[model samples]
Target: MWPPRRSGGGDVKHCYARGHRDSGLVSGSSHVRSDMGDIGFKLKVLRRIGIIQPTSPARGLKAAKALRTWGPGFPSGVAATAARFPQQTAIHDDAGDITWGELKADIDRYTQALKDRGVGPGVSVAVLQRNHRYLVMTLVAVMQAGGRLLLLNTMASSSQLTELTKREGAELAVIDSEFLEVAKNIPRESIVLAWADDDAPDDLPTVASISADMPSDPHDKPEKSGQIIIFTSGTTGLPKGARREEPKDLKPLLAYFGAIPYRGNSTVVLAAPLFHSWGLINFGFGLSTAPTYVLRRKFSPEQVLKDIETYRARVLVVVPLMIQRLVDASSEAIEKRDVSSLEITASSGSALAGDLANHFMDLFTDSVYNFYGATETGWVTIASPEDLRAAPGTAGRPPWRTTVKILDENGKELPQGETGVIHVGNDMPFGGYTDGNSKSFADGLMHTGDLGYFDEDGRLFVAGRDDDMIISGGENVFPRELEDALIEHPAISDVVVTGVDDPDWGQALAAYVVVKDGQEIDADGVIAHAREHVARFAVPRKVTFLDELPRNPTGKVMKRELPDPA
Candidate 1:
């Protein structure tokens, strides 16, 4: 069980007051003490979340400083880290390792080049590239140049890219040469290629030429921090751009990083796509922690393990699918590699199936942590290894100063163990979508569009998306419960459950399955297996075998693309 919460007392106030003083944010004068009551409450919350240690004054001071300095955005953090750790290795990619000082130089050069192209505050610059050092540099440079960063998914089609860039009003697109054709819809002059080869097309200019003559001095900071417009997965339809501003308060940021145990001098191998929120958050954390970041343009499970062993990486940031791939790697291959250096494995982006979670922890020590959140609401809950071991499917408890509630269609709160739309209230909920539409917000909580319930232990368990719910013969069903049961079968490699049209039942469950190699399972066998674990109504009425399920770049199953049973 988790530790019990401490009672309210003057000791909490004293701890926060000392923390504030040590941080150099506040003086130890009577004037500061007059407001210690409110500051103390905030500190108490942070303490309860395990961000601030009760006995470690140095850790408290360091966390306080990190929170205080997080507001000026990416450029400021990069510059600060460079000044503090000039010789430290900041990023390692296919090209070579780059130090903090070298990283800042590259960012400054690109910032100057972008400024020369009239990119500044309010200007939207779309970046279309795979994971690499150039991509990282471009993101920082755009933020430094005071331009709104429009992150484009590399897996999107030409038409999808055209529509998104046009709708988002992007004036310039910095892309890899390979993706230049896909981004042809953008004006020729507006497109600048970054990762071009010797035989690159002659029509467009390259980022190399643009920055070759530019100075490495800092570019002017924007009056207001530029926004980062991250698009939704667009699994069902056109993706929406979720807008975020540089966070002003660092309390929530501190709480999250502190709870996750990301420390200074740590080495991290990031496997998730840079465009997604999970990868982006880890990038932000990297800047503050000044970790040695190992980057790869594409994900290969074996390569990820190799990088961990090569770099002695302590943490691996990934999505759930990446974890599955790692687990699926042959036992012989996994045994030959030395992954003993790994201390933590952070997973988000999608649901971490309970079976996958347990298998991963069993293979690699009990250091796996599953975080639950969406692009719109930020992070809401985190399931530690112990949480997964105790309650296999729980999403864990909310962090400090964050609240989670289950609400019905009428906006009334639901009791524990009753599934409803999950609503979250946090310090850093997204401002709104770029298109002016917003999710339902009542009181202070924002609707997450996820259907879930809290167990008796206050752990969150997501059933499925509210929109993904199916009414079959007047009995509502969620695909997650059935999918979870089906995945437990040894023959199942990967599986996704969806509701298809049915005559007798209003809608019927269909399972798209990818069977494991050397294993055989037919549609009838799948249904029979599910029947043993779940109710008859919950069993999939049809099962279609496939080489693999269609997935977006972030590894989410594309339900709309699943084929109908013959």
Candidate 2:
């Protein structure tokens, strides 16, 4: 939604909302706030974002009734968006585009098709595909049909996929056409194709094909909303399934709106894989605001710039790695495109290094939002551009309705400027691991499994993972501080510090450095750079130069893949 236009010769599309206004309050959220200021805050946010407008009262009633039938979640949100703004563009993928009305109809048909195939309530369904139109449809339709959703990483191997399918008890496996060969190993009788190309097998069963021949089946609303499971990054161990409970209030929505200035009915280019928590969260926002999402099955730095120019997008959801690639491609390809339409580059899913954030903002617009969180707990802290400029590498402050604490090993609170464990309490709390494992907590706050300290200005700075801390010669060395120092070198582009066993010191530092292109640097220079910036004990005893550090799908360094110290 845009500002009101003058009475001139220009066409303006009006973005409006109805549901909360139907409930008499502008926020349509059920809250027991006694303070009038608290009530007024949400009302202003809704109105500024075009969610509260002068519209028909009956339309608001219909929007409210649509959510009542589907229950609250992505399914209900999409249904409500369709009820209020059916003509609004909801999705724009590589194949084509679809309106809210068309998307809702397709989802409803597919929901019936799924229910007929015994994908009833509590049944588990696994989805494996890149970001695409059908993939989004199948995910929402499964939720509407009352099936527990297991989102699979597209980069997983045949063995991992097979193991995950059997381990999660996913009765059905919906795969893209390219991965049909890998699907053979999933060991599921109800294997369905999410999408297929021209050369796909003739007997392939797709969601479209299945829905085309399916009968109209009417069913009552589900007694309970289905659970959504996002697997952990298998860096530490085997991937564990983590489910999120159904939201109790509009706190999550209000919290996001309060921090990130998201507009209604805008265009967003999602470069991040939709299977991950970060991408899926943005997808949820797109549904609520009815943004025209531009999705590509694969990610390319150059292609992403092109998409931004083509779509004139307002927001871009991605991991930090994509920003690095964009910067790397700046001279070669990205500089040619007019990508100034981007207003917010909301990065999550992996660590957003301080240097990378500033470099990106310098090259592009000053719109980098460094989101610090995990798959278990969403958006712990968001560093705005102002926060990043004021204090680089700082995770900024917690958003609304969020609590963050730095606690010592004994579960006691740590004062500011003291590094300790990070515990958080927010609307997007974890629903425990599916394997019955859960994160440790203290005083109603979930332990984030991270080490960090708060600055004098209340900014959070994550030192590193708790396990990544090294005790070399009885001196504690945090790799993040050293890595941040080394990345500032003019010749170095990236670096990662880790602990290595040493006979001299109980444990030693090993730094993997990625030198900038056309620059020459060896172990001596790298060691000198480290020694100048960090303590002698924190300096790397061994330096290994690499073209690039290996990373997982979500841009996390796969430390296990690093070679043994030479």
Candidate 3:
């Protein structure tokens, strides 16, 4: 075990860190000395020390000084690795492989180009494109230049993008060539530049000329310097922009890297779209950890397996749906492919179906993990491979850094094994809503709208979203639990359960399904099949066959868009 150093003043030092063990038991907070537990003591200690003076090197620029131990113009942790392993593969796509050195060079060139474009600190640049090596480079350049980075979904309607550009007053948009037409919708004041791929840097003239200046240290950047702004589809209508700033305490995120056990010496496969927080964070953290990253523009079961074999990836990060899709894919190639190198994998964005989680563990022989977090709330809890083996549906205990409290509607903490809303926050919490009209992170905790509870053993189990709850025939139902049962049908490939406005039952359960190829199934057949697994009241009264379920760029089911069943 690595010995603990004196935690710089004002920082909370954890007592114990959850390390890797083969037992599949998830770890919890270290023991606190002053009566309180580890996280509880740290909370009290941080409250005791007021915000540090900006000029003090011990506090003001801690992140910056950490960077100086490396090189110049390298703001991200990944840049340091390039100097050590220049030839190793950094990113793999149809475009070809990008070496660590090549990625660093591309970022430097782009950083200079962005400077020429009148972009600098406090300026927010929106990027609208799919996942690719170029997107990764652009993100690093924005952070390197002290500019706020905003990710724009290419799938958004043109009108939506236009309003967002105006709302945030985006200074410029770096977009793919295919999105140039959509970029025209932005007001005349904002500039748009096409992302240059292989050709000559023709747009360099448009970028403003500026000297290469690195922050004297990571801590030198303004505390309010917004690093990334991710827009979430609002339940009501438009999207909400969730801005994540650089935290004064980097220990939380850095701990995530260590806890997951996928840093340096490993290749992290990125199968999810970069537009989502999960994909974006996975990419950024990989850079900090200096692990090789493999990218796929879109998820395809066959392509994913092939990439894993080709890259010899040791770590994989993806959503539960993607995991299910890959697992459902033909196994003739699966058995033949060499996946024995994989040591750690993470599933996030949604809950892992209990059965699917079991199937994955059985197939992987216990190297799969599940992390619970949201775009709004950073890292909450994690169910490592060991933890999941112990409790199949639990989201695991809170991360070594964050604190969680399950509270009922009355805002009081609920007793163990009782259901309530899950609230999480810590020193690493990022303030929210930079759009003026957005949600602010007022309290120390982020109220996750998810309904869940903690077991006697402190394992978190998610029930469903507070909004997704369905009241049918006066009985409460969570679509997620019912949907889990629907996927068990042999004929069903993918399914979504939603509530349809009903006259008699207040609301009725409805199912939208995609059946396997050459498979035949109908509404009654699915309802009858699901009835055997779940209560009759929870079964869908109506099932509509669809080619696919509507999802946002992040692969989350867009329940608001599902058509009403006839």
Candidate 4:
């Protein structure tokens, strides 16, 4: 069951019922006292589940004393975890399984190889590899050695990789053999480390003997160190690097690890690319919990089910397109597969509608969790099954430690029930954009460009992007509301709503649709169906059908490339 919304939006409460009270209050006086006791009990439960915290910072000093500590120069996360949980499985890749101990050894060797190649602190190393164990090894080694990591997409062309390499001013480029052709484009000035398929060289300097006796530096602050430069999906223009400033404190990481519901020993099917924040965070989050990760180089509906069944993956990050594909594959595929292992399923990176939320909840029962977040913002709010059941489109109120506000173009905070731009403030906000002196943190708030409004019921419903709104006949139309209605049709597989230029209306609503397999839907029929589902003005004035919608690697719809009909 979902918990009650907090005073400020975005505070999520996690509670699991243990047992019910047996004794019934006999007198009104007792009932009043019992109600007070119940409120106190719920407050304690909220604290335990990380929904609230003590105002007295040092109140938990005794408990904090018992927490595990990591030294500054910790070689790798695998090594650290190995010391804590040696027998536990650390990684499960196509190459094979590696325990925490074994993974640490690989990290040690990789660190030496990096050191041998003159890669030290302050240097940038670009990694372009599929989601394999090597990627983990590289990250561990680079971070352990106090270096910066720049993740590049394996699907990027040779020319694209070369440009990115130059942009980052990389000191080295590591690539899997499958993308060796692209690696060839990298400047010869940068060393190329290639792995032949999954069989990486054990002979590499990764296992070299370092001054281990050199009392491992307790505070290994390298010249320049931290996870910076997460690239955005170029839905508008060229991708920009979102630079992150490392927090001197680990409170946010600790808060996230504690707040996020992670079932231990569960298997997580990773379909998104690690180069993306969604995938990288999944990796970090999985590592924080030490869950089993079943990696996939790319997403295929068939493969998703197969991997879920094969590895008994209990959790996975999914986009809207993937959800539609998996649903279309077969409802039976979901039922027949041993998805009983699943406890939590999170969907993000796009707006999810009530109909789709209902469909998923009906299929998976209570496992579906709608997560609203962005690459810029880590995790803003999470809509639980109970929230979906109560208010389908409401992206659950923010987390316990987060704050959000909806504001109009005039910089005025909008009242409840009004749609406007969404701004957020969290403990772990990203630093800013790279390559320029621009800053997103203006007036102490992260402007989420996304337009949404809070309901009187205290739930936030995302409308669409502020820039994506279409003005038709002098009235504004949000694509998400219209898209939500259009997607309800059985014949529609996927769709994107955008504004196209118009002489009379200044701008008109246009829809680019991908019809379901073996089904035919024309522009007229699509618009007609929408007319019944939504306002007439919100219905598309034009429609273009394509075999598939143009999407970035992360599966986000590219509305800019929406083509006009001949």
> What is candidate 2's local distance difference test score?
0.77
Better candidate number, 1 or 2, judged by lDDT = 2
User: What tens-digit string does per-residue lDDT give for candidate 4 at 182-258?
Assistant: 77776644644444544544432222223232232223334555454677777766666776544444444543443
TM-score of each: 0.88, 0.91, 0.81, 0.81
Q: Which ten residues in a row have the lowest lDDT in candidate 4?
A: 14-23
lDDT of 2 by residue, 1-566 (tens): 11111111222222111112112322212333445755786887676555676656776776677667765577777777777888887888878989888887888888888888899889999898889889888878888777899998887778888888888899988889888877777654578888787888877678898888654333356776778899888875567899876665677777677667778777899888888988988887556676788999988988888888988988988998898788778575867888898888988887776488888888888888878898887777777888888888777667766777777788887643456777887887588999899989996788898887655556677778888887878766678877888887888888888899999999998989999988888999988877776777788899988888878778888787787765
What is candidate 3's lDDT per residue for 4-57, written digit by digit as tens?
Answer: 111111211222222112222234433333324444534433332211112345
Lowest lDDT block of 10, candidate 3: 1-10
Q: lDDT scores for all predictions?
A: 0.76, 0.77, 0.66, 0.63
lDDT of 3 at 539: 73
Worst 10 residues of 1 by lDDT: 9-18
Per-prediction tally of clashes: 0, 1, 12, 9
Rank all candidate structures by their TM-score, best first, as comma-separated numbers: 2, 1, 4, 3
Tens digits of lDDT, candidate 1, 21-101? 122222112233334654775565445433344434554454445345445467766776676567889888877899988
- Candidate 2: where are CA atoms >4 Å away? 1-34, 214-219
